[model samples]
Target: MELYKWSAQATGLGCYAYFCWCCFLGSLAEDINESKTSCCCISNILAVYRMKVRATLKIRGDSFSDACVVCWCPFCAGLQMRNELRNRGLA
Candidate 1:
């Protein structure tokens, strides 16, 4: 289960799940580079640079508006992702 309810928003119709806007954008760019590099880019923008939450949410670039959401909102989406990566020693 996902910790952040807002993290998995429905992209299209029929309740299909899509990542949050920032992550969604990053995932779209996943094909252009190495997976590790891509993850690094996103993570750097969301967590390391701004309000580091319990879980880090990475985006292809720094989307400050969304970052603020992750930072201020108690139900932060980034915290969930950050923990998963950290548990695996990936973050």
Candidate 2:
């Protein structure tokens, strides 16, 4: 994942997420749910969505592992998703 490769859009998203992570989560969740990208703000649903993201990105992990990552550090996960999507021209 291009974690350090922040475009203007990603930079803005990172800033927003850094300050209002909950709100950012909600926004990202909506994007994930409504757009071709997928996920949700709720922890349970988000965990499931994280699995989908893993599949979409071809990342290696199980449901429990993805859940743990999302639970512990959703912002990082979101940022990674954003970068991946942008990289694939899917965002």
Candidate 3:
């Protein structure tokens, strides 16, 4: 009877250890997912900011603006240029 009791206790401890390991792994996965999500959010924000800054510079005839002109989506940039021109009384 004593032997049986010891075997049962050992089995229970093994199961407990397994459960703890699984929980730890699950938490690690969540942390990785959160990090990836935050990175994507930051990348999107930077892209939008770059677009706005490019538009502003293009409208102002800044030399650095000539590096790349995304003519495919010209409306935003053109509007920016027009607005700047109007603001400067050059329109």
All candidates: CA RMSD (Å)? 13.8, 5.9, 29.7
Runs with alpha carbons beyond 4 Å of true place in candidate 3: 1-64
lDDT of each residue in 1-91, candidate 1, tens digit only: 2343223332231211133544543532342222433444553454433333322434233457556654664133444444333444544
Candidate 3: tens digits of C-alpha lDDT, residues 1-91:
1111101111222333345533422332242232323323332432343344335334233323422332333223333333333344443
Candidate 2 collision pairs = none
* TM-score of model 3 vs. true structure: 0.26
- Residue 54 displacement in candidate 1 (angstroms): 14
| Candidate 2 stretches greater than 4 Å from native | 1-12, 30-41
Q: Give lDDT tens digits, candidate 2, residues 20-79.
A: 766666665664564423333356666766677667666666778878876897667667
**Quality of model 3 by C-alpha lDDT:** 0.32
Each candidate structure's TM-score, on Cα atoms with residue i matched to residue i, is 0.24, 0.61, 0.26
Name the candidate that leads on TM-score.
2
State how far residue 59 of model 1 sits from its true place (Å).
Answer: 3.7
lDDT ranking, high to low: 2, 1, 3
How do these models rank on TM-score, best leading? 2, 3, 1
